[model samples]
Target: MSDSSFLNWPFFEERHRVLAAALEGWCASHLPVDHSDVDAACKGLVAALGAAGFLQPSGAGAGEKLDVRSLCLIRETLARHDALADFSFAMQGLGMGAVSLFGTEEQRLWLEKTRAGKAIAAFALTEPGSGSDVANTATLAEKVEGGYRLSGEKTYISNGGIADVYVIFARTGEAPGARGLSAFLMPADVAGLTIAERIEVIAPHPLARLKLEGVFLPESALIGKAGEGFKLAMSVLDVFRSTVGAAALGMARRALDEALARVQARKIQGEPLANLQMVQGHLADMALKVDAAALLVYRAAWTKDQGAARVSREAAMAKLYATEAAQEVIDAALQLHGGDGVRHGMKVEELYRDIRALRIYEGASDVQRVVIARTILGEAR
Candidate 1:
């Protein structure tokens, strides 16, 4: 219900507009309500989206390639309707991002099943002791008789307990820092792999701690080359980070929509709340932030789709600006709602919780700032 004029920006094409409108209608019919059991709900959502032919953009086929703009459009629209739905859709793309970008024919087969909703996928790079510092990952993968033995833990993994396949990263050598790591594709039922614990957050989603416990993976489990794990992980994040920003923009737009409806319907003293200067000021700020965030989000998505080998700098800026702005916009929305904003089950209340995680995930806002600075200063290139 927010403005659609932005879809006409140079960053988008006629197809993107068509995609947004179609997905918007589909979400209106399919994803209006919230879910209680995050795990089961996400699984159901994955199946539903795949049945609807919406998850194919997450993976590429023999003659097909991923279009990042479509990924952003679907995420933005789905998020506008429901964040859990967005999460369900986002994970499908993000979990399969490496495979979609670098997987061989056999790996692509798994991605095809994931796109069809036959299987669930997870990206497991963050460990109990290593997060932003990928160089320090403790999960070790050792060369063995037939394959590799993986032993360690990965925490804060989305789709952790329920995923059918995981794109896991582990240290395969002694090279210093991020050089020795490698990527693997391990099935959920693999021997010695266990979901050690489930994590409950303020905004509920399926998250878990995985204990590999010396699980042995076949040589086929490898995704890219050995010692390319760090590079692959960063590459995947580079592509999906802009989509994360798009998702935040959707939530912010929803918050603005909710706030607008509230203010117009709400009265203060003797006149409508919209008549008050203070309320109008809040609405103006929220609207401004939403537009600004949308620009950055689409710009990054556009840049990626334009054949840039990497959009790390653009993605970092988009994610940083959009997520931080979303927090502010949702906060203004809550303030506009007054006491009702904090009231349980209120839309603004839900948005307030949902927007917080955006700032923290994919890469924290602070980390994004560091990335931006390094790129600008020529420290990273």
Candidate 2:
């Protein structure tokens, strides 16, 4: 059901081909874990991914940088097999991305554990009020006697309740709006930190709302420099946002595969459903979407890997197109399945749930349009 032809595109290297094949084989045996207990399933997937060495690319080693193409490939494959598996693998990179990109030598110790799948990691940037308006983040990190006292709320945080560490963003008041924000590495057990609510989404990801009365962190807990949180967050998103598209691509590909299979297997009026002209057209459109999405997703990733300072515009385009395209592709597949598409225990049903959040998270589709518009307008000026 998976398409391997895309791996031959110029955007990928020989190493990427090898990595995709190897990970695909691994996922065939390990994915689609029991999700009845979402948190436990995520923890198990993370540990399994870590032990298998598939998670090594999630974080960079000393003097090493993250390979975006590899990250995208791993995510695509995992998502194709299991959305939960993809989620587990992705959070490791996203949760610790700030540290991997800008943390001091001492702070990277957490990277070792996260890369090894020994600990869970979370990225806490979304607040109840801010949503995509990151500049409006109201969390405060006041300088105390020895360290900073963080007091704010973070909602819709991934890997929230079970995370061992979090890359949390808060306002340090160094300036105003986005400039005043800073990133910190706050351990989950820190005093004054509370999981106020466990948020259940259409997809069963481990999400939570957190309240911090006065979570204290030593000077060492800061990631990068003060007032650099917004920069750090954007940098991390620039890297991971494309991978989100890759994940969506994976799901879309699965949808196409499922649609093809269903069409050929099911019969209508004493003939295979696939024999119908309309079905063929639908299949053609689905295939077209998947391929176009693949092109954009890898283009952004390849551009970033080539050492462009920031692929913000490319990343946003890739993310927006791929996710939106995936949703369309998946819905077409589900429609092709007739009633079975929505039936319990169906893969397409699960994918239908999984592909939705991709559009909303990281950066919403509307936000991507704004970013693209601003970049082009700024360049025009």
Candidate 3:
């Protein structure tokens, strides 16, 4: 809706530009500004995004092929308009991405159902003891006569309480680490699976902790090979992380727009704030950071689209830079807004909260720094 500059980059095609325009128009009309019920709002956004066909780009096609660039573009646009809308669209793809990437035909079929908005999907990997240290997962899935019995708890799960289906990870081997892990598709209606608690954060979406007590999933539920769950999860993150950056980019762009509008119209010292040299300097700095973030995010997305199997370095760089820079940009926008920035119902106020979580989720800023350093050092070897 803002502009098509990013779509014109070499990373996108004509279709991507068209999608950007269409989604922008759709979001302008569809996104609900009223924040009455967050859950209902999310559900409505999901159904609207699905109907508008924007959610389609989040996953692989019918043939197991995904367009990462399109995914990033969609996130960037949706995020600019509404962070919740972006989240709704993203979770659909991320929660079901494993199935799209590594699932058998049956899994793909299930994913198709979820992708079409008929069912909500979730990804359950985090546990109480394991946030960044995924290998330290204590959740266990023991092989049984007919299937696997999953016994573990996943905390901080997005869409945890609301999802109809989940891609759950659990340890299956005696080996002390990630080697023994496996991923399974567990439906919410399955016996022994429960939403333990709904976790609230600064920016509220549908988040919860899950308790799995002897959850029996048939062998058909396993995604990819046993011991490949870690790889599968990492791979999925590789694709989605950059999109996370794109989401941040969208928020930053919105912040910049808000700042520009405020500066241009608000009067100060007998003239408009835009007439102040200091204000111009702040705007310049904000614009620089935004462009830098865009470059990193689009570069990562483009590299992945070019068929790079693992984009750990690029993705980390993108996520790290874009999220961090967006924070600074948003803060500047808030500064520009003065008292109005923190007003209860102001857009920048909401964005301040929305942007805060991006720095922590998907991967935290510190975790991304470590990831980028590791990749750089590993390449030198």
TM-score of each: 0.98, 0.99, 0.98
How well does candidate 1 match the true structure in TM-score terms?
0.98
Task: Give the per-residue lDDT digits (tens) of candidate 3, residues 263-356.
Answer: 9999987799999999999999999988899889988888988888889999999999999999999999998999999998898998999999
Clash pairs of candidate 1?
none
lDDT of 1 by residue, 324-380 (tens): 999999999999899999998998899899989898889999999999998998954
lDDT of every predicted structure (CA atoms): 0.90, 0.95, 0.87
Better of 2 and 3 by lDDT: 2
Cα lDDT tens digits for candidate 2, 165-260: 999999999998999999999999999999999999999999999999989999899999999999999999999999999999999999999999
Which structure is stronger by TM-score: 1 or 2?
Answer: 2
Off by over 4 Å in 1: 379-381
Question: What's the lDDT for residue 151 in model 2?
Answer: 96
lDDT of 3 at 55: 72
Give the backbone clash total of model 3: 0
